[model samples]
Target: MIFTIARKEFRSLFAAPSTWWMLALMQFLFAWFFFVRIDDYLQVQAQLTQLANAPGSTIAVASPLYSALALMLMLLIPLFTMRLIAEERRNRTWVLLLTAPVSVTHIVLGKFLGLMLLLVLIVAGSAIMLVTLLLGTHADLGLMLANILGVLLLSASYAALGLYFSALSKQPVIAAIGALGMSFGLWLLELSASDNRSFLRAISPNAHFQNLNMGLVNSADLIYFMLFTATLLWLTIRQLNDERRSS
Candidate 1:
């Protein structure tokens, strides 16, 4: 049943013309950044070769692309997730689910998974460009894999957070703004916090994502992403359960 809902939601997103437009725009932006990175890398290749411990092609090119993708995800995931529950409620479709036998947990998980599958498509598109680099130069497969894992986990966290905000309001615009504001604010906090041990920065997902971006795989960072994503998902489930009871 959860998978069914997920499949339906995934198909509905692609069915919308807006989704295609947004995807087109994102692809253009990603390709522009990717080509620019490659050009810059080529321009500096001579100088980098002279250094005792120069950064590899993966670090010089792929890493920055992933960094940009990370920022793009922060912006795009909220937009994608905004309609998850908010649109359903706005169109009076959510009421059907409320009256159905499906558990709140299933609904939230299904919605999140559906959106995540969409994100996977986006990540795969980005990976194609990254892999193309292998045709010209040797690529760091381990670092690339780590970055991929980091991106997937980061995007999932964004989706889960956005899902909670979507569950909070019936208006999609309000949901998008609220989710983006919270996600962006946390990202800003990661930059503004001076103390390394400050609780605010420590709690931000961007801080943990930076560690993964460095190709350092820590269990703690993995745990942080899991806990952050799970906490929001749990809150979303509670919100739905409350709504079901109230209705």
Candidate 2:
């Protein structure tokens, strides 16, 4: 049942022409960034090589590319997730879903999984672009794997946050705006903190994302992402359950 709902959401997203346009824009943006990174690396190759502990092409290129995509995901995910529940409510389909045989957890998790499939595609595209470096230079596979894990967790967090906001309103625009505001604010919080020990920074997913981005797999960061995503998903489930009971 969850898989059925997931497929339905996935198809619905792709059925919209805007999704295609958004993907095309993403490809263009990624291509441009990929080339820019390669160019910069080439320009400073001499200086980089002379340094005993200089970063390789993988760190110079792939790391920053992943970081850029991570930033882009912060914006893209809200738009993608805005319609998950808000659209259904706006179209008067929310009651039908609420009355369905499946539990609220199935509906919410299905939608979350559907959105994640799309995000996984985006991550794959970025990975392919990053892997192109292997044709000309040695790349750090470990760092690349860590980056992939980081971005997946980060994108999932964005999706979970947006999903919760989507459950709060019938207006997709409001949902999108609320999700984006919260996401961008948390991101800025990470940037605002001067020390790693600050509680404000601790609340932001981006702070933990940075540790993974550096290829440092700390158990605390893993726990943070898991707990963060689980909390949002649980909240989304509770919201739907309340709606079901009230209806």
Candidate 3:
């Protein structure tokens, strides 16, 4: 039953012209950045070779591109997450979902999963550009895998937060603004604070993503992401239940 709901939600996303337009815009931005980074890397190849006479010099050369890609992802995720639930509510489709035989948990999970799946495809598509770089240069497979995992986990956290906010509002524009404001605010806090605020840093998804990007998979970081995602999902479920009861 959950899968059925998820399939419907996933299909709805594809059917929506706005979703495709956003996806097209994202792809264009990704491609443009990729080309610019590759071109910059090529220009600096000579300088890097002069500085380091190492076997993995090409991998070192590609580090800047990876960093740029990560930054772009951080900016892009919230936009995709904005409409997941808010649009349904704004269109009055959420009432239909509430009256369905499926449990609130199932509905929330199904939607979350569907968004995650779409995010996975977006991530995978961006990765193809990275893979193309590997053809002529030696890249670290393990490092690349770690980067991908970090991206997925980071995206999951954003999606969960977006879902929660979507449940809180019936206006899709309000939901998008709220989600972006919260995400950007959290990111800014993580960036602006000193190391003395390590406790606060641990709570930010961007902080954990930094560790993952460095190829350091700490269990604590994984747990933080899991807990963050789970808490928001639970909040969304509660919100749905409360709405149904009130209705």
* Per-residue C-alpha lDDT of model 1 across residues 1-247, encoded as one tens digit per residue: 8899899889999998999999999999999999999999999999999999999999999888998999999999888898899998899988998899999998888888899999999999999889998999989998899899999999999999999999999999999999999999989989998987789889988888887887999999899999999999999999889988988
Q: How far out, in Å, is residue 234 in model 3?
A: 0.6
Q: lDDT at 41 for candidate 1?
A: 96
lDDT for model 3, please. Answer: 0.78
lDDT of 2: 0.93
Error of 1 at 34 (Å): 0.5
Weakest 10 consecutive residues, lDDT, candidate 2?
125-134
Assess the local accuracy of residue 226 in candidate 1 as a C-alpha lDDT between 0 and 100.
98
Q: Report the candidate with higher lDDT, 1 versus 2.
A: 2
Q: Name the weakest run of 10 consecutive residues (lDDT summed) in model 3.
A: 54-63
Give lDDT: candidate 1, residue 136: 92
Error of 2 at 165 (Å): 0.2
Query: What does candidate 2's lDDT look like per residue over 112-153, in tens digits?
Result: 999999999999988988888889989999999999999999
